[model samples]
Structure formats: C-alpha cells, structure tokens
Target: MPTVWVLGAGQLGAMLKQAAYPLALNVEPVEPDSEHLPNIAADDIVTVEREQWPDTPVTRHLSSQAGFINADIFGRIADRFHQKSMLDDLAISTAPWRVVNTDSTAQEMHAELGAHVLLKRREGGYDGKGQHWLHKDDGGAIPADWLGTGIAEQKIPFDEELSLVGARDKDGNKVFYPLTLNLHVNGILMASISPLSRVAHLQSQAEAMLGKIMDSTGYVGVMAMECFRVGDALMVNELAPRVHNSGHWTQAGACVSQFEMHLRAVSGLPLKAPDVRGQSVMINVIGVERNIGWLKIPATQCYWYGKDVRPGRKLGHINLNHPQKSVVQTALSELHTLLPQNYDQVFAWVKQELERA
Candidate 1:
C-alpha cells in the first residue's frame, strides 16, 4: 500500500495520522518548511491539509509528483477569483461579486455590488483575517494593498449558515454525510451540528450542488462546501478542497469519519455513505484553558490539539452524540456548566437551536 504524505502538519494532519493508524496504513504529516524531504516513492500519495503552500523546493518537488491527488484543482480553488468564476460558469448560486483591480474605485464597487460590500484577499486568509467591510455610509475605501488582489462581494443577508462535507474517489464514487448547521463567532467557527431532522429537506439539494462541483473538476478526496441559507435556497459561500472543521462531528457521530474517508478515497478503497447514529454537536475549544472536566458529560469526546494556548486560537474541539435529541441536549447542558462563563451565550444559542431542531 502507498504511504499517504500530508502537507501542512496542523490539527487536521494530526487527526489524519490518528485515523490512519487503525487502518494499518502509513501516514506522515510533514511540516511545510522543513528542510528534510520524505522519499517520494513511486506509489506514495501526496495531499494537502490546507489549500495553499509557500513556494519552496520541497513543495515544488512533492506537488510535482504523479501521486499528488487533485494537484490541478487546488490552485483554481485557492484563488477566490478563479473559484467564484468556476461557480459562475457552472451556474451555481453565489453572492454577486467582481474582481477589484488596482485602479478600481469604491464608488463603482458599491454601485455594482451594493452599498455594503466585503473585500477578501484572493489567497490566504482565515478566521476573519484579511477581510475588510466597506459600508456605503462610511464612504468605505479599499486598502491600497487589497486593491488588485481582492474580490468584492455583496454582503449577503443570510438566514443561517450550513455546510456539506463529502468525498469522491478516483473512480468518481461519492459519499456524503448529512448537511451540518454551523455558527461563526466573529468569523471563527464556534459550533456545528449534524443530521438535523429539521433541515432534512435540504440534503438532496446540497448533495446535487456539491456533486456537480466534484464531477466538473474531477476532484478526488474530501471536499467541503460552505453556504448561506436564505429561505429555502442556498448560496455558495466558499469551498474547502480538504476536510473541514464543520465535519469534526463525524469523528464521533459517524461510522466512517471524514479522515478515514479521505484516506479511503486517496488510497483507492471502496466508498460508501457513512452511518450517522444520531444527533451530534461539535463545539470548538478556542482560546480556552484545557479542562478534563469536559469529559464528564455523557456521550462526549474531546480532542486536544496539543498546542500552546492563545487568544482566538483553536486549541481543540469536543463532540457529543446520542440517539435521542434530549440526551444530546442534556449533555450539552452539562457541558455548559463545565465550560467557562464565556460560553454562556454560545450554549444559549446552541440550546435554542436544539429546541428548534
């Protein structure tokens, strides 16, 4: 069997390594800037945890290999300009948007998109970084650096946010978990819940949209699509060409976790839909001190990334699952008490969502 070499050894890579152990498959998480290079044996597979990589000899050599999966797709998807263009070419729904050229004026952007516009760097930004909001009332000006490198989009008035995490194998076989409902706190993912009976009606629509993308691009392995729900329709927000944080619930909630599914896809293993046993919720442990008490709640599992704690950093995540929604709800209540006081509003929001579910 070919060893899977993952670029960018962050939490996602760590989890991939963990998921590989049970399958008796060799998986390596290599640091992006390491001077050392793994032997790229003819059959060894290459994949990325994050979308982009620095231009280095190591990256160039690895990405140039025959075994690198979805190599051609990454660049197109990584650049927001190309990504939005592809979506438009496919006639997929997304926010109205246009490229911001160096000579472009804020007046034209506002006139074209809307009074409220969002400018995002074409490449490299996460957790609300590298973004600027231009409000018509404020006479919003585009940062000089952002000009020619950003894409301006109409500020969407979304009712809720949702995501679909799915995988496609080399033969184009695809499998998807149920759509997940997500909440972002200040542009960072805070919580995710999956297999909601309330939103069940949207599953097929979500699958069809994502399937079209993978099919068109011949994309293999795990891909995630984030969207905004306006009434019964979904507008594409962004796409991740790797496993996503929203799918973290699958680790404890599904029979086949996303990590395993990615491995299976890239390794040429069989594909099948994962069995989701019950309602599941994933709470991101951000900027908070570690607490062993988090495990005290029933049906709860915690994963710590072993990173030094810092404000606004994702240190770990906790997942809860149960056959009955009430059981999951009770566990969440217990978890709330065990968490810091800062979690009060988060819990309140999640619990309220549970009642609605």
Candidate 2:
C-alpha cells in the first residue's frame, strides 16, 4: 500500500485516517514540528491541514514547501481574501469591506463602512475568535487587540448562511455536495442542515463560484466555500482550503464522505460524485462531552473527538439522517424536548428551516 503521511493529528486528520482505509492507503499521522523525519521514504505522500504551514527539510524534501506538496494554491487561499478587487475579478460578490491597519480607530472604520462593522484579523481566526463588532454609538474607540492588520466589513443582515464542500482532481475534474444551511452561535457553528430546501435555487450559482475559485488557483483536493444568502443573491463569505465543518454531515448522509473525497483527490484518484443519501442535519458538540442519551435518538450518529473539554472547543458532533425532512424535524423536536435549555436556539432554527422547507 502507498503510504500517506498526514500532519496534524486532530479531528479532521482522524476522520481522514478512517476515510483512507477503504482506498488501501496507509495514513501515518505526524506532528507538524516533529524532527523524526529520518525514517520516511522519499516517495511517501504528505498532507497537512490549511492552517498548518510546516517549514522543514523533510517537508521541503517531500515538496519544495508545505502548502505546495499536493494542493499548490492554498498558501494564498487559506486566509481571507485580502483585496476587494480580487473578489470583483472572480465575479464573486462580498459585503463591502476594506483592509484596515490595527491602529485604525473604530470611529474611522465606522465613518467609512457604517455604524455596524465587523473587524476581523487578516489571518488565523476561526469559530468567532479574532473578531470585534463595533457599533456606531460606541464612539471612536477601537478594541485594543484589534489594533493590527485586519479587514473591516459591513455587517450584513443575511437571510441565511450556506456552505459548499467540493473536490477537484489533478485532471481538473470537480464534484460538489449540495449546499448546506448553517446556524452559528456566538460566532461558532452550532448546526448545519444539508441539501438546504429553502435555498435550493442558489445551488448552481454556488457551484459556479466554487468552480471559479478552484480553477483560478489551480486547486487540487477538497475545498470549502461559505456564502451569505441575501435576498435572491449569494455573497461569498470566505473559503476554507480543506475539508470543512458544514460537510461533516456527509459522513453519514452521503454516498462518499468529504474526508474520503479529500484523500482521493490528493492521492490522484478520480473524484466521485457527492451523492446525498438522505435528509441530514449535523449538530456541533461544542464545549461539552458526549452523552449516550444523544445517540439513542433514531437515525442519529455521534462523532466524538477525544479532546479536552473547554468552554468553546469542538468536542464532537451529532448527525441525524432520515429519509424525510419531517423525520429529521421530529428528531430535533425530541432533542429540544430532552435538553430544552441547551438547545433553544438550535430548536428554533431547525423549526424555522423545517417550516420553510
């Protein structure tokens, strides 16, 4: 079997390990900064997550640099799009935004953007961290921590948030899963419903935008693009250069999971169509440990990441797959009934989507 070395043995890496077995690929997990690279063969294929940029002789030997090893374009695509002109050139719509210096006062940003502005660090922020919301009435004071290079974007009152997970092979072939509807709590993703019923009309546009991004970057492997649905239009929110959270529903609800598709793409295999098996919803298990009670629900599956529990950490997720949307709704209702306090927001969102569906 061909050996594939995966850097960063986190949850995604573990999912990749499980996904790689069916292809007869051996996945060896390695620490990003480990110096024990002497034993690896030259031909071994190495892979890393988007945020992990390892610069070492072994990584260089595997390829000239870290991001270039397999998917050569990620070093540029992993972070938020730095220039508004870039999005315009790609024919993708985004909220009005401007790159601002850290020292720029919120008053100045408010003056330029509006009363409601979101300050985001140019790099390295995820799940609602590294962001500051400024209100016009708050005066000119900028958050001390936001005093660095970042981007200021107008806070959009979007109807909903959607994400698409897709894969591309070396031959330029591409395949994508259906757009997933997402709900966020405190900037962290709390739940995702795949094959969004209300926004089914935007699928083609989403696919076209994703295609443009992958083609423009000569991207290989799986890529995720998040968007905001405003009225009848979809505005690109950002891009994730690897397997994504929204697509986690694929593990139980699709013919081929996103993790497997990513490995197949990077391994130079023909990409498979992302065929949905059923109506599905994936709930993020954040800041809490797993409870067996959750798994007892019909058609529900739980994925627990063996990590230390923290207030905002993603410890695992629960996916519910059913043949009909009504069944999924019932499951959500039962969940809310079981844990009303913890799932109030989740139940409300799921109920709204179910009604819209």
Candidate 3:
C-alpha cells in the first residue's frame, strides 16, 4: 500500500487515518516532536493540517514551494497576500474585509454585512478559535501578531453558514463533497448536517468560486470554501485550504470522506467526488464537558481525541448518520443537549463574538 503522510497530531489527522486506511492506503502521521520523517518515502503522502510549518528539513522540502502548494495549507499556506489579492480580483463577493496593523485604525464597514465585525489571526484561526467579534465601539486591543497574521472582516448576518469541502488535482481536475450546513454555538461549531437545506444553485455557485480559487492559486488538495448566506446572496466568509471542521460530517455521510480525496489529489490520481448518500449530523464535543451519552445514539460515529480538556477546547466530534432524513435533527438535538453550551458568557476573559462594527 502506498503511504499517505499526514503532519499533525490533531483531530484532523486522526480522521484522515481512518478514511485512508479503508482504501488500502497507509496513513502516516507525524507529531510535532517527530524528527524521523525521512523514514517514509516522500512520494507516498500529503499533509493533514496546514497551520504551522514544520521545522524539519525533509518535511519542509516535501511541502509547499513557490511553483505549487500541495493539498494542505489551510491558513498555513504562504504567499497569503498574493492569494488574498487574487481572491479580491475574482470579484467574488466577500463579507466586509480589511487589513490592519496592531494599531491601525478601523475602517467604516458596509452596513449590510452586519452591525458587527469579526477579527481573525490570519494564521491559526479555525473551529471558532482565534476570532474576536467587535460590536459597536468595542474592538478589542489588537495584538502585535495581527500585523503579519491579521485579516479582519465584517460579521455577517448570515441566515446560516455553509462549507464546501472539495478537491483539485495537480492536473487541475476537480471534485466536490456536499455543502455542509453548519450551525455554531458561540463561535464553536455545534453541528453540521450534510445534504444542505439550500438548493443546487447555491452549491454550484460555491463550487464555481472554489474552482476559481484553486485555479488561481495552483493549489492541489482537499479544500473547503466557507461562506455566509444572507438571505439568497452567498458571500465569502473565508477560505480554508484543507479538510475543514464543517466537512467532518462526511465521515459517514458520503461515499468517500475528504481524507481519502486528499490522498488521491496529492498522489496525482483521479479525484472522486463525494455525494451525500445519506443525511449526516456531525456534533462536536467541546470544552470541559464530556458527553458520554453521545455514544448511545443509534448509528452514531464518535471520535474522541485523548486530549486533556479545558473550557472552549475541542476534544472530539460525533457523526450521526441516517438514510432516512427524519432522524438527523432528532439526533443532533439529543447530542447537543449532552455537550456544554458556550461557556464564554460565564468567563470574563472569553472574548465576545460581536464587538467593533
């Protein structure tokens, strides 16, 4: 079996292993302290997470370079300024956006996006972390890292948030998984349902936008296009250039999960698009609360990372699948009851989601 190398010891890498294994693919995981990446053949694998760049010479040589970036590189991808500029030129609609320094003044935003703004640490923000919301005149003190890691956007009054987890191969071939309708509870992803509540037009639009992005960046791998849908208009929220939290529902919902697709994309193989053959509800287990009852749900697929927990920490996620559409909501509601509601409201240090608008 060809080895598929994934870097990181996080939840994303764990799920990638499960998906790649069944396809007779060898999934190789590299933890942060791992220094033996040379043991594996370079051609056999791709990365799982794209957040931090590795310090190892062997791994660094295998990952992204100027000519092309591999299937990883979510927020971790380089040449970000150029990529962001390209995204803007696509004339692809986006939420209110601006780049600021640690002490740069805030600009007036469009009224329609929302009466709030969301700040992201252009480097490591995901699953509702590394974000702060500004409502009214309450923009938090800008951190110095925001100079290099700063990308800010208007908070949108989206009817809902959705993500498209898809792939593009080196030959520019493309494949897409279903758009997952995401629901967030206090910035942390609460649940994601496959077979979106919206129509084909929206999914197609999202696919087209993502295709343009891949074409522009010359990116190859699994990517997810996250956006805000305000009424009928879909606006870009941000781009995650790897398998995303929203796509976690695909573990049980689709014919092939995103991890398998990532391997295929990096290996110069034909990419297989995934269809949501069944309704899937992926619920998260966040913070200090362990929802042991989640395992009791019928047809539930649970993955618990053996990580020590704290408030607002992402510990595990459960994917509940059903061929019948009826059980999706019931399963989600029940599992959600077991998870902790946002503890941010209780803590003074927990950043509020809505501030400077």
Highest lDDT, which number?
1
Per-residue error at 97 for model 1, in Å?
0.3
Model 3, range 78-116, lDDT digits (tens) per residue? 333434556778887886567655455443432433457
- TM-score, cand. 2: 0.91
lDDT of each: 0.93, 0.79, 0.67
**Which residue pairs show backbone clashes in model 3?**
5-45, 71-221, 122-149, 133-355, 134-355, 134-356, 135-355, 135-356
Better of 2 and 3 by TM-score: 2
Ranked by TM-score from best down, the candidates are 1, 2, 3
| Model 1 agreement with the true structure over 1-357: per-residue lDDT tens digits | 789999889999999999998777899988879899779899999998999999987798789899999999999999999999999999999999999999998999999998999999999888888889999999967889988999999999999999999999988899999999999988999999888788889998999999999999999999999999999999999999999999999999999999999999998988888999898999999999999998787899999999999999999999999989899999998889877887787888889888888
Order the numbered candidates by lDDT, best leading: 1, 2, 3
TM-score for model 1? 0.99
The model with the greatest TM-score is 1
Q: Encode model 2's per-residue lDDT on 177-223: one tens digit a residue.
A: 99999999988999998876667888899999899888877778888
- Candidate 2, which segments miss by more than 4 Å at Cα? 52-72, 81-85, 337-340
Output the lDDT of residue 266, model 1. 92
